[model samples]
Every structure is written in C-alpha cells, then in structure tokens.
Target: MRLIKRLLPAFSMAVASAAYPVEWSGNLAVEVRTFPSTAQWPEQKDNGLSLSFQPELRHRWNDGDQAFTFIPFVRVDSMDEERTHADIRELKYLHVADGWEVRAGIDKVFWGVTESQHLVDIVNQTDLIENIDGEDKLGQPMVRVTRVLEDGAIDLFLLPWFRERTFPGAEGRLRTPLVVDTDQARYESDAEQKHLDYALRWNQTIGAVDAALSWFDGTARDPELLPGTKGSESILIPYYPQLRQAGLEFQYTGEAWLWKLEAVHRDTEQEDYRAAVGGFEYTFVGIHDTPLDLGVLSEYHYDSRRLAANSPLQDDLFIGTRLTFNDTQSSEVLAGGIFDLDHAGKSFRVEASRRIGQSYKLSLEGQLFSDIASHDPLAAFAADDFIRIELTRYF
Candidate 1:
C-alpha cells in the first residue's frame, strides 16, 4: 500500500502538464480446477475456483519521449487464503532521451528464453500461489537506466526493496505435507527486505543471433525451506540468503529453426552451483497444405546440485509440440512433457486456447503426474492429476 501511494502521486505529477489522454486495457478471468484424485492432505480440497482482474493504464506525452504506466492485479480464491491477494503488476514512469532511457518505480523484468524453465530470470519474485510453473511474478521496485547503441544496449539497475515469494496455504492443493509459515521468515541481511540490490546487463543482437550477459547481487529470491515449529505443529520456515549470480541468455533465429539457451552460475554463503537449459525448436509452416503450423521443441535441463536441487528440473529432458491454426479465431494448442533421467519421473501438460467472438477467450489445461519415483522431489504430488478451465474477457 505504501508503494502504491508513493507511485500514484509521482505518476500524476509526471503527466499532469500534458493533455494526452490515458489509454486503458486489461482482462478479467475466471478459472476453475478439478482434481481427480483424493486430496493428499486433510485440509486440502478436491476442487478450486478463482477470479482475477488486471487493469492497465498508460499515458504518453512529449511526443512519446515520456510515459507513465500503471497496472494493478487482484485475485480471489475460494479455497486458499494465500491465493486471494492483490499486487501492483507495474507502476512506472519512463523518459526517453537521445541515446538513453530511464525507468523508475515498481515493474517486472524478464531475462530468459526457455519454454520449460527460466534459469536467468531473477528480477521479480515468484508468485507461487498463482501457478506451479513459476511464470507469474511479483513486481519489483527499481530505478533502471539503459544506454542504447547502434547494435547493443547496456542496462543498469538500482533495486531498493525486495518482495518475498508467495507460498500456498495449508488449505491449498499442490502443497507440501507441512505448511509454510511466512510470518517466521528469516533473512541473512541485517536490513532484510530493505536490503539494496543491484544488477547490470548487456544485450546485443548480431545478425541471426541475440545474446545477453547479466549479473546480480542481492538477496536470493528463492528461499530455503527450513523445518520449524509453529506452536505445536511442525511447519516450514523460509530462509533467504545473500547471493551473487551471473547469467547468460542466447538465441538464434532462422527461417525454420530457433535455438535458445539460458545458463546461470550462482554463489551463496552455503553453496555455489551452475545450471543451464538449452533447446532447439523447428517449425513446419503450412503443414499438409493447410493453414496450420506445427512446431517441435526439445530441451535439456542440467543442474550441478542434482538430487540436492531445489526444484525437480535437474537432469531432465523436455519435449513439446505447438500447433497454430492461422485462422480468424487464432486458435493454438501446446503439449509438453518432462522426463527425469535419474528418477524415471514424468510430468505432462496440455494447453489449448481459442478466441470466442471478439471480446472473450476460452482456455483449457491439463496436468498429469505419473511414474514418480519415491526418491524424486515431485513424488509427493503423484496422485494430484488435475485439469483447469479458464474464461477471459479483454477490454
């Protein structure tokens, strides 16, 4: 709330003198999920429903040299208290000059090019309650300066505040047996969330290839789940440590092939490790003499931590296919699976979406977990096969 209050006045002041009109756009969505298997925990539910709204407002003045943007998001869930929350997705002011640009306030920055996992994306905190894939993020407060060149750019960041990662409540499905107690969170820095962090990146595009190198020094976004006791019940406590990370992102674009790689080497007080994800995607345009295009994707994930890694993507192979129908409705379907090489675990997902009429869209998704070994990190959710349906209205 303090952040919102601070940014709103700044935004009004930045664009008050200009007579340009503000543009408004966003979406309202309702989502439903059903679990076929029984709940793993006694407090969990078999079905869940949520409603979310995100509205964006943008204003540009001084002939596109200056701009202000505000985006707010909120979600209400029927089953999980932690899932029902509100956030400022973006609230930033931008100033463009001859060869540089400056952005200030809370915003989101993404820095990876992978379909299965994002290894180099660390600017924003993960909104874990929204999804298990870690695609959603909470906005970060920063002041950024970018120096543009003929073929490359350099970005420098000054981050003032850190947002903690969200976790599923005890009543939420797809959670561990013991709930996470967020109130007991601990940090290595004396200032905790107020610790100042900084980062820099250099991005360049040379012909058919795009590459970026980045470095960050800050409190780690992902926390270590340490065992603790909340009253009489055992729970997990989040412990954040200071970290330094170096990341690289590479992509090659061709007529029919796309190659991507994201790698990171991170160091902390406790440990240091390297992880990477590399893949190639090939597209078959106008397959079978039709207007449909099919793309095949293959990726490999590797981590030095192996079994000691935090997530389940260590030493795994991912294969996926995307089908796009070049029609008026803009229909698409994506199916993918990850196979664990060491534990014989498999995770599969399918997603399909199509526009309805002019203002509405419908999407369906299914997740299947099978053949998980007992030693695998994802073995706890072996019985949690679920499907999701979503309806979104754009305005």
Candidate 2:
C-alpha cells in the first residue's frame, strides 16, 4: 500500500496531461492445466485452473513526441492462491526529443537475445509462479534515458525500487522441498527495498553483428536461498545481495543463420564469477517445396562455480528445433532440451501453439525432468512432469 501510494503521483501526472487522446484494448483468457504425474507434495492437489484478463491503454500526443501507456493484468486461479494475483505490467510516460528518449514509471526491459535463458537481462524481477521458465517478468519502477546517435545508442537506467521474484505457495506444484517465505526475505544493503540501482548500456550494429556492452551496479536479482523454519516447518529464506556486473551481448546474422552470445561477469562480497551462453541457429527455408521452415538450434552454457549447484544449466548444453508453418493462423511448434554434462541432469520441453478461428488461440506445452543428480537442487522436482493447455480469445 505504501508503494502504491508513493507511485500514485506519477500516475496522476500522466492522467492529467491533456497532450494526448486515449486508446484502449483488452483481452480475456481462460487457461487450464493437468498434472500427469502424482502430486509432488502433500500440500498440492492434482490439477490447476485459472483465468486471466489483460488490458492495454495508450495515449500519444504533442506531435507524437509524448506518449503514455498502461497495461494491467490479473489472473484468478482455483488451485493456487499465490498464482492468483494482479500486476501493473506497464504504466509509463515516454517522451522523445532531439535524439533523446525518456521513460518514467513501471516498465519491462529485455536485454538478452538467447533462446535457452537470459543471462544479462536483470532489470525486471522474475515472475516464477507464472511459469516454470524464467521468461515472465514483473514490471519495475524506473526512470530511463536514452541517447540515440548515428553510431549507436546509449541507455541509462535509474531503478528507484526493487521488485522481488515471486514463488509458488504451499499448495502449488513445481515447488521446492523448502518452501520460500517471500515476506521474511532479507537484503544485504542498509537501504533495503528502497535501494536505488543504476545501469548503463551502449548498443551498436557493426557489419553483420548487433552488439551491446552493459554494466550494472546495484542489488543482484538472483536471491541466495537460505535455510529457515516457519513454525517448525523448514523453509528457505531468500537473501538479496548487492553486486556489480558487466555484460557483453552480440548477435551475428547471415542468410538463414544466426549466432548469439551473451556473457556476464559479476563481483560480490561473497563470490566473483563469470558465466556465458553461446549458440547458433540455422534455418531451412521452404522445406521440401512447402511453406514451412525448420530451424535447428544448439547452445552451450558454462558457469564458474559448479559445486552444490542450483542452476540446472550451470555447465550444460542445449539443443532445440523450431518448426514454423506459414499459414493464416501463424502456427509454430518447438522442441528443446538441456543436458547437464557434469551432473548428468537433463530437462526437455515440447510446446506448440496455433490460432483458432479469427479471435482465438490455443497452446500446448509439456515438460520433463530426468536423471537429476542428488547434488543438484532440481532433483527435488524431478518427478513433477506435466502437460498444460491454454486457450485465449482476443478482442
């Protein structure tokens, strides 16, 4: 409530600006999931059901130099209380003038281009309860400035408040043995949640490569899990620490082929390490005289610290394929898996999606975790394999 109250002034300023006319659009979706395997824990049930609503509003005026946008999202779940939540995905004011752009309010920023995982993308917190994959992110409160030049672009970010990552509740599947108590989490900095973080990125395209060099000095997004007790029940206490990170991202483009590299080095009081994910993809266009295209992808991920590892892909290899069917519905199917070379752990995913009729869409996804080593944290949820389906109707 305090945070909402503090940020209301920004919202009011955007609303009071008469420089623009408003345009709005929204969508309502119903999604369901089934757990093919038995219950991973006693607190969770067998299946999950949910409904979501998302609406987007935009206003642009002042000769298109100023703009405002609001995207609000909510999901109601029958199986998990924690998953049934709402978010102000994007509510910001943007202005552009003289090769300069500024954005203020809650927004999402993506920095990396790899398919397997994001290494240098740390602006927004992960919405882990939304999906097993770490793709979904929580909007962050920030004020950003970008300078556009002929050679390249430089972006500066001022993060006022930090948003913690979300986790599943007790009655949710795909959770760890030691449940996480987000409310009891601790921060290493004296300023706590109000710590202001800063980041800078200079991006440019040279020849066939689009590359960026970034540096971040602030609180680390990845929290260190610590052991605790919740009224005799063991739990994990997430601890957020302060750190500095430098990242390099590059993508080389060619005819029907792409090479991507995302690498980062970080320094903290406790540890200093470097990690990288490098991969390439080659596509077969118009396969067999058909309109469909098949893309083959392979990536290798390496981390410096590997003992008692929490990351499933600490020292792993990933291989995947994407099949795109050139049709009116815009359908696509993807199959991917990651292999942990050192720990003999592996995880596979199969996903497909297609549009239905004119205003509806359907999606199916399945995940399997296999041969998880005891030293790895993923061994706890190895038995939790399930297939999920979702249908969305756009307005």
Candidate 3:
C-alpha cells in the first residue's frame, strides 16, 4: 500500500508534464438497462437495472513538422455493484515523428471487420451490454512502433499480459449455469503459470483501399476440471497454457461510404480447439442531411472439438443506424439476429439510445432467443430478454 501511494503521485506528475503543450478537453456518458424473464425461461426474470458512467480526457501535443495529434481517452467507469466495479479504460501516450510513430500504454486495438461481432475485441469498455457481461480480456500493457514506407507501414507490438474469464452474460447481470463440465470455474494464481503475448502487423494502402494483417501469439495459465463432476465427467479450471491467433483485415474508406472485411483463425492446444471467424461491414453516411448512417455486419464462426462437434457453424446479422442531432447529441437504433445456420435456433436483439448531452444519455436494449425446430440440445433453453433505463453523469 505504501508503494502504491508513492507511485500514484509520480504517475500523475508525469502525465501532467506530458500534457504541458496542450489544452484540456473531455466528455462524459451514462447508461442503464433492465431484463425480464420470459415463459421459456421463467426461472430467470426481473434482472435488476445496471448503471454506468465514463468520463474521458484528452490533451493535444504540438510538435513542429508533425500534425497536431490529440490523445483522447476514458479515465474510469463507476458501476453500481461488485459486478460493475471501476476499471481502467484507456491510458495512451503517443509520439509522431517524420515517418515513425510510437504509442505506449493501454488503448482499444481494433483489428476486425464486423461492426457488432468482434473476433478481436481485446480492450474492454463499459456500455449497456458490457456492464452486464464483463469483458473477456483485461487491459494489456503494451508498446507499439510503426514505420511508414512509400505506400504502407510496418507495425510491431509487445504486450505484457493478463488473463480474464468470460462470463455467461453481461458483467453485472445474472449468469446461467454452466451446461458443460468443461467450463472454467475460477482463475488460478499459481507461480508456475506463464503469461505473455506478442504481435506483429502490416498496414498498406493501395489507391483508395487500405489493408492490414496481424499475427498474435500468447500463453495463459488455465485450469481443467477433474473427474466426478456433476453434469459431465470433468470440468476445466483456469489453468495456464499457450494461445495463438492470426488475423487479416481490409477496408475501403471512401468519401461517403466505407467497406471492411476481416478473418481470424485461433488455436488453443490446451483446450484442444481451433476456431475461425470471417466478417464484413459497410456504412453509408450523410443521408438527407440528417447524417443517416446505415451499417450491416455479419459473422461466420466454426469450432472444432466440442460435444456437438458436427454442428460447428454459427452466423449473425446486425442492421443499425445513427442519426446525429445537432452537435452534442445523437440517436442510434440497431437490430440484430443470430442463427445457427446448421442447427434450429435464432436470437434477436433491438437497441435504441439518445444522447442528451456530453455527460448524460438514455437507452433501451433487449434480446430474445427462440428455438425454431426440434429444439437442438443447445437450444433447449427458452427465450430470455431484458429492458434497461439509466441516467449517468461523468467527472
């Protein structure tokens, strides 16, 4: 505790000095949500409301010959309960030179194509949905360097890692029981476990199109279940092992339209599973002067080594729009559906939100799952849905 207290002041001083050349700017946002159980899943009902608020700060640094770059970020989020604990959201330091750039600290690293379904969402933030199901990965300490060439740039990054558990639902929301014994029960903190991650990427621009390719490899400690477990013969605890993944992405950002595509392949020897995902997104802007933004996102996923291994494909679709009202406020509406193209079930979601100001917002989001055919064993569960309303203020 004494050491932490000593480090805090030094950290703050460094950050303050780093912002010496810039002005201060920030924004705040808040949200709330609620869930109600349906006939299909009567046991799960009246999930309480979740509220969250995030405040951001940004500083602009001036370096001659280089453009004025601003690093905008969220400082922290305050939640209502243990499920909604405060966590570090973003902390980035950037330096731009002639043809070289360096960025260090924690920030969102977007490396995929799907607008709604992200196969590589390593950074976690607080939102209506995220507040319910916590993020799968914690903030990773990293340093990145980029060098620009004639038409592209080469990038390299090193990440000092951490491991996180994937909850059944949103962070603060109630969770369903584990249907399989293979599910992890808790995180392990043994000394023998190793955790480290490294990545390399290249981004190039051709005429009016841009493309990026990245490879990531990491090792984590995971736990496995022993024999004599309840539902199944065994379960897996959070032990440690190696995890590897590679991904490629492409995008075309035109004057009024944007197109994106991405694919990822992941392998985990510990879990004895291999998975792949492919997705695409397109957005058109400025319709009738209302800033109408329309987007469609789709994802195809396949997994090897599961109880029902034969059925390995799942797909989802998301259609959404954003309407900006004036300069400080906006409204957004989205509809999504998930289908087991190879099975007999579907899940649908509808979400809407209104930004009242920089510090406050209102929203409504819900999801429903239906079993269409003979109720695939995986689809035996009934439809589950919820409604949420929240008010937030940021510091």
Candidate 4:
C-alpha cells in the first residue's frame, strides 16, 4: 500500500509539476454495444454501455531534443465490471542526439504488417481486458537505445519489470468458465516477476521493401492456461515461463499492391514452435468513374503446433475487402473473414468509421463466429456475436 501510494504521485506529475508546465490534449467517448442474444455463459447481458476519457500531457525543453510525455486513460462500463479500468498509456522521457537516441520509462512499441494478426510484435503485453483481439497494449517500462545507420536503425532494449496480462472478470462475456487468478499465478523462473528481459531489433528500408529482424530473451509476456481443482469447483491459472524468440517482419509497398509477412519462432520451457502469416493487398482507385476505392486482401496462417492450438486459425485463410468513400468526412469501411482449411469453422468482422461535423467522430465494429466445430475452442462462443458503436469528441 505504501509503495503504491508513493508511485501514484510520481505518475500524477501533471498536477504536481510547477517547474515544467504541462500541455494537455485527448478524447472523451461513449460507446454502446448490443449482443442481440444471451451468451452461452451466465451473468452476461444482451446490451451494454461504456464511457471513456483519455488525456495526454507533455512537457518539452532543450529545443525539442528532450521531452516527457504522459497519457492517462480511464473507462467505465454499465454492465461489465471487468471492462472498467484505468491505465497510463505513456510515461516516458526521450532524448535525441546526432544519429542516436535514448528513451527511458513507460512506453509502447509496435511491429508487424498483417491486418488480422500480429505475430512478430512482442514488445508490450496485451491489455486483454480492454479488447479480446489483443490489439490494445499496456505501457511497458524500459530503457531503450537506438543507433542510426546509413541504411537502417538498430535498437536495444533493457526491460527491468514485467506486466501481467489483464483478464475479463466473472461477469464479463467471452470469458472462460472459471475466472483466472492473475495475482496467484505461478512462474517457472526463480526470479518470478523480477526477471529482466532483453531485446534487439534492426530495421531498414530498401527501395519499396521495408523489413526488420528482432530477437528477444527472458520472461515471456504470454501465459499458458492451467486448470486446477478446488474443494468442489475448478479454476484456471496462468503460468508464465522464460523464453527466447526470433522474429521477422517485412512489407513491400508498390503502386497498387502491398505484400506483408510476419514470422516468429519461440522456444519456451514447455514447447518449441514457429508461426507465420503472409498476405497481400491490391487496391483499385476511382472504380467505375466514381471517387470510391476498393481494396482486396488475402492471407494465410500456419503454425508448427497445429491441432494442439486453441485458435481456429492454426491453418486458415483470410480474405477481406476495404472501401473508401473519399469524401469530405473521410469515411472508410473494412469487411473480412477467416476460414479454417482443415476444420469447419469461420469468423467474420466489419469495421467502419467517419468524422462527424468538426469535432466528433463515429465508429462501428462487429464480429461473428460461425460454422464452428465442437473441437474448436471458440465453439462455445458461437452465440457471442456482437456489434459496437462509439462516438468521440476531440478538443
């Protein structure tokens, strides 16, 4: 309790700082979602509403060579208690010198190319409580150094602490039968959460080809699910193990087509496996004399741990389409589906967004699970299809 009280004020610098004045900007939003039907699980509802606020604060000096950033975010939900949360998206200090840079504190980094999934992105842990698809990430504290080269940049990272993945509460939909106890989970390392991690990445762009090579060692950000029996009940526990991983991400941007690839090989205490996803996108502009653009995407996924996987995408095909209105409001839409080649399963999603008036924006997204077999892990959530709408105000 004392440690937390001490750290809270450090992160609350926007209110306490008098020496370095802070400037703030961000968004406030409200969302409504409908599930249409009851979930297969209990304590779940059909409709829900949530409100979120995020404020970004920054202080800079030294002619922009140095700066400090802080982004505090929070959300409240009417139905799902698990969805209500708060987080610091960024709390970092950055310094740039000639051909070199240094960053220390909490930050977020992203890597990968495909639209459906990100295989080579492992710098930050996923904030699963915010979204199930692992698209949102928690801030990770670390020290990073970058060296600029003639044709590429090399980055080095020293991570001293680890963050646990958030899970949905018992009342949350799309959760497992037994709630996962993240605090009571086990670790294979003797250092437990004290284990330090390290990583290196080299990125370069040669003509139209942009690519990167990365390697990571130490504690794994992902945890394995383990089931245990209580007195008269059962529970699921997460187990994290030390690991080493090597990854590659590349994309070729052309006039009308883009090719993307991501591959990773992981060596863990319990398993050694590899996974890859590759795809391409082609766009047609000014279709049929209109100001509309259409894009088609196709991708394939493969895993060495096939059949032992919990996802339906172990060996699957993904096809999607993108639509751009090219209007004043800058409206765009995307529709996609993934099909399991070996099994009878499919998943579909649609997302669209547009700016309203001058300061408001509206977005809609939905997902559907269909044709799932009993053997598929997602079969239980077949009735969990839902659509969500959000309206945001920016100042």
Candidate 5:
C-alpha cells in the first residue's frame, strides 16, 4: 500500500503528459518584507526575503470531459526555515458526464461568503507560513462526486489523508511567544493522519440570492496550541481534535450592492460553539466620469464563546474600502481595519497591486497593530508592524 501510494502521483503525471498536450502557465515571485520595530525575540530578524514559484500544468481529452491538472509550488525563505518548503498545490483527475462529475487526487477547495473571515472553508489545511489571512491552503487528497442540477449542485467528498497546518518557526515574525513544535503533533483520533474524513454540500441560487449548506466530519483544521516543554525550552504543541461542523453560506447580489454571510456550528469532544461573519459591500461606479469604482465594506464577526474563544475575531467589526481602476493595467487597492469591540484592539491593513508590463506585476502591502489588549491574541504582534513588497514574472 505504501509503495503504490508513493508511485501514484508519478504514474498519474506520466500518463497525463503522454496522453494529451500539456498546457503550461503560472508565475514566479520575489518578495521582501521589512519591519520597522525592534525584534521582540532574539532569533527574529528585522528584514526578510523569499522567492516562490508555482507552475500549473493541465491536460484535457475527450472534448473536455476528462482532464488532469498539476500545480507544484516551492518557496525559499532567508529568515525562517519552516517558511521555506515545497508543496503540491494540486494534482487531480477530473471526469464530467451528462449530469454529474467526479474528481480524485489532491485539490484545493474554498467555501465561504464573508470577506473578513471564512468560517466555512474547512477542506484544505491552512498554509500559515505563506500568509496570515488564511488565504493560502495546502492541497487535500479527496475523491469527490458532484451532481449538477438545473438550479443547484450537490457535492460529496471522501478525504483519505489529513494535512497539518503550517506554523512559523522561531525565527519567523508574527509568531507566538513560544515556537510551535510541529514535529510533536497530537491527534484525538487513533487513526491519526490516516483518519477518513468526509463532507457534503448543497448549493442553489434563488433569484438574486445564492445559498449553500454543508456538513463536515473530520479532524479540525485549526489545532489547539498547548504549552509544553521541548528539551528544557518552552514550546507550543499542536493538538488536532475530531470535529463535526455544519456550515451555512448566503449571498445576495443587487445593483451595486452585495450582502454576504457565513456561519458555522462546530462540535468537538471538549468544546462546541457557533460562529458567524456577516457583511455588505456597496459600490459607487464612475465617481467623476472616470473609469474608477469605489466599494465600501463593513462586516461583523461573532463567536458564542466570546472571550473564551480561541479565535481573535470574536465580537469584532471590520470596515474596509476597495478601489478598482478599470484600466488596461488593472490597478487595485484595498484598505481595512478590524476593531475588537471588547478589548479595544485594532489592526489596520493596506494592499495594492498593478501590472507593471505584459509579463510582470508589482504589489505592496502593509499592516499595523495598535492598542492591543494584553489578553488579546494579537498582543504578541503589537510591535510587529511590517510592510511587504512583491514582484512577479508570469510565464
């Protein structure tokens, strides 16, 4: 079984490349991050650099009824060894029929409706070393079947393997006071990483509203950080508990206005809680007769656990603005702030990007933390404000 599992990926790639003409795309990026504040930990650095590459290859046959896709990613970081890693972002085979489709292999899936937080996206484990917003995810090994309906779709997934979430090492910034010992992870399930997880989702569109209901039975992607000792040094041990979650997503699109909501109820052996994020975005197009659009967004996040919640978003509010320049270069910018209602902690962020030329792009991002409560999760980052720049070349 182990031998076959090891060779399956290679064998699938060989077959795909031989049977069809491969289509190639993706990008290579160089990133630099700068911190203005002094390092809180002696092992941390004030500046960092990294290079990342992701190439996508696809093969399709039978007039698009059958296909194969492969996406491999690698990153080399100068500051943190844990951040320097490689992953298969996607490697999947897909087949489509009259009313249904089937896919198998490693893939990434997203399910959420709110902009501030995604409470319902649970299929893929988070790649925290790549980013803090949970926008990046590791590919998951799954076999999924989807039934297409006239106005809706139903998807069923069987996940055979589990991917642990990545955490920053001792040298990485925005880390906990104690470094996470990823090597000593503990799981509630006796089967551990081999535990079989499954999920089901149904989505439908009615008028201007789109809705989805989903349920997942599996190991929780967000592990509990427990304090432990590692050879006379303090460390945080990751503990994965079994979880059953029910999720709800809703979005209503109107003329220049979008309303979104995402909610989840999660049950575990130690704790059970309900969490939700709801928000709206209103856009003003052609403010002064130019091809510019401005969108105002506001969202509220709530967790039943409140102060006891493991998440930092409990009882918080997010307000942001998105500006899009409808030009050839596709310039865009987003600025936002999340305010903790209970603790008086706030974090502000700004992100902007534009195409430099036909094959290159430039992006800038910044974050600021202020007035963080001592008990707030973000207190550790109070002195870790930084700016990031990225240049990418697309091939």
Candidate 6:
C-alpha cells in the first residue's frame, strides 16, 4: 500500500509537470487537558493530564495557468511514553487547473454539520473517555480528483485502510457475551485493504442568500473492543458500511442580523447494526454597534438503528449560544440531551468555552447519564458522569 500510495502522486505529477513558482506557509497548535476527580463518576477517580502539539506546513506553486501544492503535518502527544513519538496526520500533494484538480496523500476529510457528531468529524482527537489505551493513529492515505464546474464541484477518492485490534477489558467481560481473546491481532496486510470515498458539492446564490448541497461516501474502522470486553480473535469491525451522507446549508446576511441553517443525513451499516442519522443546525446572529456580538445556535440529532428486538431509538437535541466581546474574546454555552423515545433512559451534557487571547482558549465539558432504557447493548458501558477540561494555543 505504501508503494502504491507513493506512486500515485508521482504518476499524477508526471502527467502534468508544468513549472510553477512555489510558496510556503504553516501553523502550530498545542492543546493541554487536565481532569480532576469528581464524585459524579466514581470509576474516574484518578486525576490525569495530557498535552498534544501539531504543526502544519504547506507549499504551493503556480506555473502559467496551473498550480501544484503540497501539505504535510505531524503531531506529538506528550502523554506518549516515547516523548518524541509522532503521527503523520496529513501529507497531500495537489494539482490544479482552471476547472480540474487532483490530490494524493494522507489527508483529513469532513462531512457533517455538527462539530461533535460521529458522522461529520474528521481529523479528530479521540474522546478522553473513549480512548482505550491512548493510542493515536495516522490519517488514511488516499487519492482524490475533483472537477470544478461553473457553479458546483464533484470529487472522488480512493483510500487505503487499517483496522483496530483490542483486548477484552473488565467492562467488556461483564457486558458482552463474546469470549475473550488475549492475543493481539494484526492487519492482514497494509497493502491489500480496499477503501474509498466519494463526495459532491454544489453552491449557488439565490437572491441575497447563498446555498450549498453536498454528498459523501466514506469508509472507517471501529476502535479496538472496549476496555475489559471479552473478545479473543479480532474480527473486522466496520464503523460505517459504505457510509452515505448529504448536507444542505443556507446563509443569509442581513444589515442587523445573520441567519444560517444546515442539515445532514448519514446512513451506515456495520456487522449486525444498521443505523441512520439525521441532524440539523441553525444559527441566529444579532449584529449591533457595540463591541459585543450575540448569537444563538440550536441543533437536533436523531440516530435510528436496528440492533435487537428490545433496542430503543436514540435521539438527541442540543441548544447553545455564544457571546463575543471585543471581537477577540468570546464565551459559549451549550446544552445537549439524549433520550430513548421508546424506552426510559436519557443522558444530558453541558459545555462551556472561553477565549482568553488571540492564541489561547479554554473549555469545560460535562455529561450525565441516567434512566436505564432498553438493553440494546452499547449503553451498558455508559457512565453516570463524565467531565473534562481543555486549554489550547495557536501559533
């Protein structure tokens, strides 16, 4: 797979090698997180902290009417036992013309309307509560081609794949009926896996409003079995089966107000699970002469799945607002709740963030789980309370 991925960029470049002037730019970002013991979740009694830093670099050259660009990035997490350990998050080369473009590399792809949804987030940091052993993997390698029409664009990609293999931990043993596997499993071959992604987007202006529509299909693998699960032989777990998604967004700029709305749909198939998600987000901005700007955002998400005879539907709603001061400092508040429409379980979350300076920001997030619903499985491991704090700096 490595050889194939490397050959693709060379081949594409060879097809159109026009000399171009090169330009370079890059940015660095660091994030630190710390958690304190809270009585809300007894299982999370230990205090922990982690730090991560990522640097990005890019070069672009324009020759005549064509352009070539390359971007490569690396990330290091201080929590890693090997202080210098790193992961290649992005390494892509691109060729562009008036209406055609091609790219190849390990890159990040995004396909959703919400910042926190599983369907739309790419280049993500694993949730602190979800990291099995705090292992961070590299981005997927792929080749993509895009065509820019007069008012719209279409793209297709070929992806290289990898899988996660995990051991059964205590939590897995008590919840899942599957037997435990102690030996670590290996990928059949980094060279033979087949993965692909395709996307299309269209944008147009209607009167005073701008609108966009997008579609996506991509592949992803599941994380290793949950800690403490009883699973011995590692089997392929498809996080999403030929995932399909579509999004529509509209924006209206007004003299004293701005309005935006976005909607998305995602469908997935994995093992014995078939799920679909529909989500929407709306934002309202009140423009004033004062230095402060006031805005509100509301979103709704629904996840429907066929797990077992006794499973319940998963649905959630999120409402939030933002207050910006002096154009440089801001505060945001968000509330989200998940409930089983057919059963009796529910979960709620409250999160807040504040920007300290042009380069620094801080955030606190917390979640609560209660009311046992259906026995659909995944919920068994849900904790009563989960909390985390984050500080980030951009350079």
RMSD (CA, Å), each prediction: 4.8, 5.4, 7.0, 5.1, 4.8, 8.7
Clashing pairs in 6: 168-229, 169-228, 169-229, 170-228, 172-228, 172-229, 180-232, 181-231, 181-232
lDDT of 2 by residue, 150-244 (tens): 87899999999999888888888888877899988899998988999999999999989999999999988889989998888899999999989
Give per-residue lDDT, candidate 1, residue 102. Answer: 99
Clashing pairs in 2: none
List runs of model 2 lying over 4 Å from the truth.
1-20
Model 1 residue 84 distance off true place after TM-score fit, in angstroms: 0.4
Cα lDDT of model 3 by residue, 1-395, tens digit: 99999999989988876766444444444444444544343333344544443445455446432322333323222322334444455567778888998877875465655554555543232232253322333444577788988899887877765535433332233332322232443333342323446778888889878887878776432223233355543323434345566777777777655666666555666444454455555555565666566665555564554334423243333344434333346677777776766565676767676766665567676767667455353343344455655554444
| Model 4 misplaced regions, further than 4 Å | 1-21, 229-232
- After superposing all C-alphas onto the true structure, candidate 6 shows an RMSD in angstroms of 8.7
Checking candidate 4 for backbone clashes, the offending pairs are none
Against the reference, the lDDT scores of all candidates come to 0.93, 0.90, 0.53, 0.87, 0.95, 0.49
In terms of lDDT, model 2 sits at 0.90
lDDT string for model 4 (12-108, tens) is 7745565566678899999998887677777777788999998898887776788999988899988778789888889999999999999999999
Arrange candidates by TM-score, descending.
5, 1, 2, 4, 3, 6
Clashing pairs in 5: none
Q: Pairing residues by index, what is the TM-score of model 2? A: 0.93
Q: CA lDDT of 115 in candidate 5?
A: 83
Q: Could you tell me every candidate's TM-score relative to the true structure? A: 0.95, 0.93, 0.68, 0.92, 0.95, 0.62
Q: Could you tell me how far off, in angstroms, the CA of residue 313 lies in candidate 2 after the best superposition?
A: 1.1
What TM-score would you give candidate 6 relative to the actual structure? 0.62
lDDT of 1 by residue, 1-395 (tens): 99999999888866774468788999999999898998878888888899999999998989999999999999999989999999999999999999999999999999988898988999999999988889999989999999998789999999999899899898888787789999999999999999999999999999999999999999999999999999999999999999999999999999999999999999999999999999999999999999999999999999999999987988999999999998898999999999999888999999999999999999999999999988888986887788999999999
